[model samples]
Structures are given as structure tokens and as C-alpha cells.
Target: MSKSNDAISQLTEKLPILLIEDDITIRRFVEINLKRSGFQVMAADSGETGLSLMENRRPALVVLDVMLPGIDGYQVCSQIRDRFPEVAVLMLTALSQDLDKVMGFEFGADDYLVKPFNPLELVARIRAILRRFNKDSGSLLCSGSFRCDLRAQQLFMDEREIELTPQEFRLIKVFLEHRGQALSRDDLLNLAWGEDFVGDPKTVDVHVRRLREKIGNAPSTGRIETVWGSGYRWREGS
Candidate 1:
């Protein structure tokens, strides 16, 4: 490989992967496999240590197990999103229900992996999540006057940064990904909140109300229209 290519490969392989799984056997197995694959692995048996490692080591991706002793994966995931917005999260859990999965996504996990998962598949999902974020570094998502810098994970309207909560950012991300298309509340929930959210559709309404307020009266973004009987749509043009 060329020098530049070799450097890139090393960086990719060395990209930190923190595994916060309580099961000793499972943690060891995963850590070994990840090490074999050339990833820098940090295995934490509890959520507290994992969070500590996150603060200290600053891993690029976190492989979090949902059912921790005290804090649990959901809370850990929430803290991760709140503290390290750029770090990608992949949840590993024995809870395979759709609601469980939705809850995982609601906590801001980039991907979910059920227990008894193939080691290869787990690694592949991690790679996919990392690539998804990596590929967007310099790209932009725009609708009217609102523009999102994918690399920077920041939104701007008329050249000013639009402060957004993690949930709002994820919601806007869904809208930008499916720009010009109307998304039902369920669709929005699934796309933005993940499939495990088994709550009232009204929840979507509540968030949308808040989101519209945050986005404000900008012309391009003004096209964020309610479809009356349906859900919502972000119209792109005149």
C-alpha cells in the first residue's frame, strides 16, 4: 500500500472501540475479536467505567450493552449523546423486541445489535455506522435558507448557528434525509426515534411543535408544513 493509504488504514483500524458489556465471557470474546481485527479495544464491565473511559479515552465508537447493573444502557446512551455528540453508539442487547430497539434508538444509538449476534455482523455494523458518519464530513444538507454541515454536525440559517437539542438534530436529520417527502408520525418516529418507540403518535406532534418553534420563520424552512390529516413535510421549493 502507498504511504498515505497505509496511514489511513492504521487510523481506521486504530479507531477506538469501547465495549461496555457486563458479561465477562462476552466481553472477552468481543475484545479478542476486535483486537484481532486491529481495533483499539477498551472493555468496561459496567456503565460507569464505560462512561469514565469515554471521558478519558474519547473512543470514536461505543459498543454499549443495554442491561447494565445500575445505570443501564439507555441512560448511558443518553449521557453519551449529551456529552459526546460526535461519538457513534451501537447498542448490544438481549432485549430484541421492537419497543426495546426503539428505546435504544431514542437514546441516540446509531445502530442496534441483538444478543446472540454474529461477531462478524457486530463488527460489520460498527464499520457501517462509522462509515455513515465518516462519509458525511464535508457534505451539506440544505433546504431553503437552512443548511446543515454534515461534517461539523451543525445547522445554520442565514449564516448563524441554530442551536438544537440532540433530539431536534436527529429529527431535522430525518427531514433532511427525506427532503420534499411527507412523513407520517409513525414514519417520523421510526426514522428519527427508531422503531422501538411504542408510544402515542401525539409524542411526535409535541416534538414537532417544539422543533418548528426552534427552526423559526425562515422562508425556506417555513415550508415545514403540517399535512393536516397526515403528519408533516419539509417542502424544498416555491
Candidate 2:
């Protein structure tokens, strides 16, 4: 590998992984496996505790369990997405149904694994997500009055910071990268959510709508135009 790739790989391994599992057995088991895989682990037994730790020591990725006390994984995942858009979320759900997986994604989970999964597979998934997210760290994308700081995972409109969820941040980044190009829902899902995402194609529409709302319809912020047959376009020179 090249020097840059080696640096990113080292960086990916250095960021801590937060594990939020209410079950003691599972938490300890997963924590051990994560440490064995060369990752630093921070284990929380409750969603509230996990959220609290997030504030104190933000991890690069979170391994969240579906069933938890006082918030549940979905709610915690939503909070993480809203509060720490840079942190990737990997949900562990006992439910293997498609609906359950899709629900996790809607709540901003980067990926989901059914319960009784192999420890190696879990570690692999976590590694994959970290590597993908770490690809462009500290880069900035600017257009007109908008400035996107990938380093801080922040967006600024006319120098005013605008809040965005994790999904919205990814979507906006893709749109900014492909400004003026009509990108289909599938195109967006693949680009923003990755090819492994197992959710409805229309999920792209929901996220795009939210992103548009955050960026606003003001001409200064540019516009997300909906084509008749195509999906949407981040219209440039608007």
C-alpha cells in the first residue's frame, strides 16, 4: 500500500469503538473480541450511559444493541446521528427481519448485524465502516455560501452553522461532489449509504428532503431540484 493508505489505515485502527449492550455476557464477549481485533473498546450497559459517554469521550464508531433500558438502540442511534454525525453506528438486533434492519438504517445506523453473529464478522464490519468513513477526513467542500467541513462533520451557510444528521451529511456531501448532475435514488443510495445498505430505495428521498430543508431553498444556498423522471440534482449556479 502507499504511504497515504498506510496512514489512513493506522488512523482507522486508532479511533475507539463504543459498545452499548445491556446484556453483561454479550457486552463482555463483544468487548473482548473487539480488543482482540486490536480496537480500543468502551463498553456501556445502557443507552443513557452510552449517550453520556458519547459526550465525555466520543468514539469513532458505536456498536449499539437493539434492546436497551431508557431509550433503546433506535433512539440512541438517532441521538448519535444528530449529536455526532461523524461517529459511525453499527446496530446489533436480534430481529433478522428486513423491516428491523431497514428501521435501524432509517434511524441512522451505518450497518446492522443480527444477533448470534460471528465475532469475526462483527469485527470485519466495524473495520470496513471505519475505513470507509476515514477515507476523506479533514477535507472541506465549499460551494457559494455553503461550506462543508468533513473534519468536524459540520455544515455552514453564510457562516452560520447548520445541524445535520449523519445520513443528511453523507447525502449533502455526495450532492456537493456531483453538483448539477441528476443522480437517481439508487445512485444516491450507493454513493451515500454504500452498496451494502439494505433499505428501501425511497429512503434516499426522505434524506434528500431533510438535507434540502436544512440547507434551505434560498438561492444563496443553491437548490436541490427534482427532475420529472430522474431523482434529484444539486443545482449549481442557481
Each prediction's RMSD to truth? 5.8, 2.9
Best by lDDT: 2
Model 2: how far residue 202 lies from native, Å:
4.6
Compared with the true structure, the alpha-carbon lDDT of candidate 1 equals 0.77
lDDT of 2 by residue, 1-238 (tens): 7998678667877899999999999999999998987889999999999999999998999999999988899999989987887788999999977778778877877778898999988987787677667655679988878888988878898899988765577788898899989999889988987775655676776676667767887776687889778899887644
Q: Compute the lDDT of residue 9 as modeled in candidate 2.
A: 62
Expressed as tens digits, the lDDT of each residue in 177-212 for candidate 1 is 788788999999787665644345655766676667
Q: Estimate every model's Cα lDDT from 0 to 1.
A: 0.77, 0.83
Instruction: State, as a TM-score between 0 and 1, how close model 2 is to the true structure.
Output: 0.82
